[model samples]
Target chain A: MISVLRRELLAFFTSAAGYVLMAVFPVAMGLLALFVFPAVLERGASWFHTKELTMRSFFLAFPWVAAAVMPAIAMRSWAEEYRGNTFQLLLTLPAPSWRLVAGKYLASVAVLCLMLLTTGVFPVMIAANGGWEGGPIFGGYLGCLLLGSGYLAIGMFASSLTSNQLGAYMAALLACGTLTALGSFAGLAGSSGALSSMVRFMAAGDHFNLLAAGYLKLETVTFFISMAAFFLMLTALGVEGRRYR
Target chain B: MLNVEAISRSYGRFLALNGLSFSIGKGAILGFVGPNGAGKTTAMSIITGLLAADSGAVHLGDDEVHATPSLVKSRIGFLPETPPLYTAMEVSEYLRFCGEARGMDRQQLGERLENVLANTGLSARRNMPISTLSRGYRQRAGLAQALLHDPDLLVLDEPTSGLDPAQILDMHELLRGLAAQGKIVIFSTHILSEVEAIASHILIINHGRCLAFGERSALLGADGKERGLTDLFISLVKKRNP
Candidate 1:
């Protein structure tokens, strides 16, 4: 598993893909925070009457960006192997299917983390302006990581279903979009308060909303972790199921 | 020894293997020959435990491969028809990945990597990315990967498909040497002369059925006359399904 992880990392870094991804991720975030949204970017001194910088807007924009970028990041995970016919070589190796899935997932997550880390200077730049609330800033970054992980897991599951990279990318985007949309926006349709509440509880964005607000809650953390694990398990089982069919 | 019994696989409506069976002992080079869609790759996939048979079993010693696939897989090395190369990876880098994936310890890999590269005629191209390699060199890289594991059974599908004449001859010598060292080598090829020159046993398959499975002499005519694999294949592969 470690070897697979190492190879996956090497594969990303040795190619143009990694450098492009790393640069794009933070560059997009920086653009969104500093330039894209005039309402937030030009919200005169002290960020809409508070001393804190406009990081809330960045956290809000990050998930949407992640939803799009993560699919591209993970689209090649299994899809490339399937396309190149290397699944035969990979599946026959003396390792469990879960190990391969986990290795790839971890490598991709690490790439996202590398991107996230580069954006750390964003908060630092914001802090340089004074009045930095550490809790909300920490929570904002945490929420983005959790949300990115959830999206990436879904992306890997999407990749497992097809050999075409574009198909994998679309499948992942469609799945993540629909699931997150349904979970987050289902309340708009339902007249019943209980049903709406249940949907809100189920929605990934709802939990991220809480975390980004600096409300540290166990349920939200567990929800994000389980979402990531569930999709990863799906990918592993998918790989293993190939042998039977 | 390797044994495949009653192995059958059907993909949707197409039956790829139909009760196919064959066996070979160690220190033998088994040549697998058939036309394009004759279940050769399917059989190889089954034997390597990469694909499951709908009905039937493969055994290495007393362990049924379906039951203990992980254990059996450790002792087998496979090179599929497409030459599973990582396009982004250099030849040496890919071989290192293969060796480590097979659980070759650092020292063992160090000891064997050079030899495997040398034997596959890939020493000169070790640093080149597989995507940049010529067809013949890519095939050699694939062969290099299979040999890296140093398995008890080596299953290769069309191992000499893209090689030039000299490279094909080098492959023949490599297989012979491996067999002499007691590794069971099973390879499929379209070249009849390649099989005639190297394989000690021939397993002729057609339409997912085993037409002939025997030593070189056992596949000879009733008068015990000498014949090439091409003639035997032509005579044995019945045109109409029986």
Candidate 2:
């Protein structure tokens, strides 16, 4: 497992796709948080009343950003191997299939962590502004992590569906998009009561919203964990299907 | 060293392999020759445990290939036609990963990497990224990775398919050298000359079945009784189709 992880890390760093993703994603977020959001805040947007408000905005915006960026990083995880014909080589190895999938998934999470770390300036700015609530800030960060995990799982499932990286990227975008859109007033969850609850349960926003509000509900955490596990199992089953079918 | 019994594989309505069975003795160099869509790759894939057989069993030594894939896979090395390689990684890095994937420890991996680099004549390009290497070098790197764990059996699918004549000869010689070192080498090729150059045993497959399997000399028939290997291959294919 360590060997696969090491190799995946090397590949992620060496390829141009990896470098572009690592460089572009964080810079884009930094520009958004430091410049764009502040401009919006300065435009008499009084709803963002306190440091908690600013953190909530940041947390709320993160899922959309990740919807695009995570796919760029994770879509190639397995698809590239299939395109390059390396999947056969990988499968023939003595290691189990789960190890390979897990290793690649972790490598992608590491890259996402690096991207999140780059946005550390936002938290610092919030702290500098004073009146920041420690609970919500910590909760918001936790929410982001969980959201990232769920996105990574969806991206992995997309990767397993096809050998084409572009196809994987598009599929991940669509799937994550639907999940993200479900949280909005215009989306299915907002207009319907029962669907709102179900969508709230299914969408990353439901858990993230609680975390952003400084309420870490056990049910919400369980929701994200279950979703992540479900997609990961699907990815594994997709991989296993290749050998059997 | 390797045994396949009544192995069959299918994809939807298409049959890839139909009750194929064969075995290779220790240290033997067997050439799997067939035209396109002849189940050569499907058979090799099943043997190496990359693809599962629908209804059959493969035994590497005493272990069942599918039932105990890790055990069988640990003792086998395989290179597909496209030479599965991570082009982003350096030659040495990829080889080290391949070694570890085969259950090698750090010390064993380091030693084996050095040995395979020398064996595949890739010592000079060890640190070069695979994407930067020439086609011939890429194939050599693929061969090096497969042989890195020093497996008892090697399954190569069209290893020299796209190489120039000079590189093809080099690859042939490399397989011969591995066989001489007591490794069971089974390579697939459409080129009859390549088979004649290195293989002691020949298995001619058509459609999805093995049409003939025996010593190269015997399969070619008695002197003047049959034509060259290519002619034999053509006639066998025709006979099967007819």
For candidate 2, the per-residue lDDT at B164 reads 84
DockQ of each candidate relative to the true complex: 0.79, 0.83
Error of 1 at A196 (Å): 2.7
For candidate 1, the docking band is medium
Which 10-residue window of candidate 1 chain A scores lowest in summed lDDT?
A43-52
lDDT of 1 by residue, B75-141 (tens): 8888888899888898998999988888889999987899998888888888998999999899889
Report the lDDT tens digits of candidate 2 across residue range B99-140.
877778899888888888987789999999899998888988
TM-score of each: 0.94, 0.92
Give the residue spans of candidate 1 off by over 4 A.
A35-54, A191-198, B239-242
How many residue pairs clash in each candidate at the backbone level? 0, 0
